[model samples]
Target chain A: MAIKDLPRDEYLLKGHAACPGCPITVALRIALKALGNKTILVIPACCSSVIQALYPKSGFNVPILNIAFEAAAAGASGVSAALKKLDKTDITPVVWAGDGGSYDIGIQALSGALERGTNFIYICYNNQMYSNTGIQRSGATPYGAWTTTTWTGKKEHQKELGEIVRAHHIPYVATATISYPEDLYAKVLKAKNMKGPRYIEIFAPCPPGWRFDMSKTIEMARLAVETGAWILYEEIDGQFAFTSYSKKILEGRDRKPIEEWLQLQGRFRHLTEDDMKKINSHLDEKWNQYKKS
Target chain B: MKTAISLPTLGAMGKTGTWRVFRPIIDVEKCIKCWRCWIFCPDGVISRDDYPTIDLEYCKGCGICAHECPVDAIKMEREKK
Candidate 1:
């Protein structure tokens, strides 16, 4: 669907504490529209917790419970259980977390929740690093990208959180970016209709963390998908399928060079040609595996 | 140090327009009424019906609307002292 076709209902509200062109804000706005008012958000210690605004005056019109850094999944599970007992199953319980919470600290709780077949939506708005904590390097931080903790660059490659979650054979698992709002909206709508644990990892770019122009937030997200650095796909009932943008790339469409994506951000400014070559080869290896799958 | 706990006043704080180094100016003649600016504005300060109107009292002048506008109808003008 086109951008104009999106629902005009604004649940995120104005006067939010998010920075200019914050992709997470945009992502939440779109996702909440799809989920509607009957949604209860369980957010952990992340940007969302702070950006949701200070107490009683929440930026979100929906009910949100701010839990501990590692308790989002568990919190959502409890809420879902209570709602079920009260015969309010129509109210959707969702966990909105960041990369630090999802890929790192909260993984154990998330794993347990998914293992127990908790019915809720868990979305990790991955900005690549611990953006809320002064841009420290996290497990999701990409290799050769500088962070406060990784001054030179993270030596290791980024973790495959989507594949890790998919291994659980959950009812649904998908990867999306803020650039594709329509795709994200559709995925949220699809997940909302299904039962059991659902996970979607969104590549939400952070301007301050990634060291890029705030105005280029959408452009950066689009470049990541267009360059094939970040693939868009979904796994359902043990089957995997590439989404609209990634499907074209999987069909042998020439992706924009990785250099174009890398050069735009200051975090990758120190990378040498050899470093770029290594990153490119790593991407190619992943795409080759996708083709095989 | 003592900490104070209180309910948030919710947008009760002073206007954020003072924080802007650049203020957005909307050109009605050039506007095609796409509503992109209204949807993408981080602060939700833009209101539209027929043409877009920016509420400068809350607009942080993020330039997101200006950048996202297909017709470039919104321009960021330097904030005058």
Candidate 2:
């Protein structure tokens, strides 16, 4: 269904503080369409929080609950349970925040919510760093990436937040992006229908944070999926299924080197040919093991 | 086969979290001015004249139009699907 006809409902409107071409903005629009106007949005201190001004003076179309930076998940869970107790189970609770909030400070809250299978959706809009805090490095920052904390160049150490989320064995967990509206919208609709906590990590490119052309936000997201950098998959009941990640890049089994993908972004510009080989080999090995195990 | 890549560019963030492909298609009929595909295209491959045109020449097929199309005009046809 076209996003427009999806509904005339307004959950998130324009004229916000998000950077130009911010994928998160698009993601919010699509997500809202799927969620309809029946959701209560939970946000933390991230770019999204900035998208709307302080409470009572915001630009979104639904009610906003701005919680602590590390309590998005926990807070959302509370709302979900509270809604059930009040017999308002029709309302869907969404914990929407940035990577830093989810993978770092909020990890504990997220874990707690997942364990109990909170009846809400936990969405991590991963822009890859603590973008709101002056580009500080977060656990989600990629290898060889250069964030404020990893100024010298991040060593080969980046955590797989999606894999970790799936490990919870939640009923629904998927990686989506603003670039693919249908897939993203469809996933949101699917998650909305399912009960319990659902985790969807979306790649929301930040222009000022990532050091790329403002116009290439969606391009950047596409590159992430095209290359083996991002693997779109989901885990249900322990058996995982890939959604968009091509097996071609799987294990570097039958694909080209990773250099083609890295060269497009300035963050990896400092790496030498040898560094690329190391990165490629590492990714290749990881993919192989990921598929095997 | 030429395109512009201006330097000093502050590229956006990539999930690098997965590998996926999303391609865009045009309905030609359902597509009305709107200019969404032309205005929001990250690659600038969409035509600017009257209607939206996909320059397969340089299109990486990210399916932004399909995602952003106000009407259900654009659709994502997975290369493999």
Score every model by TM-score.
0.94, 0.77
Tell me candidate 2's interface RMSD: 12.9
Q: Write the per-residue lDDT of candidate 1 for residues A78-127, one digit (tens) a residue.
A: 99899999999899999999999999999999999999999999999999
User: Which pairs clash (backbone N, Cα, C closer than 3 Å) in model 1?
Assistant: none
Model number with the top lDDT? 1
What tens digits encode model 2's per-residue C-alpha lDDT throughout A39-60? 8999999987776644335656
Model 1 lDDT, residue A242, Cα: 97
State which candidate has the highest DockQ. 1
Which docking class does model 2 fall in? incorrect
Position A179, candidate 1: lDDT: 76
- Every candidate's DockQ is 0.38, 0.04
TM-score of chain B of 2: 0.66
Candidate 1 CAPRI level:
acceptable
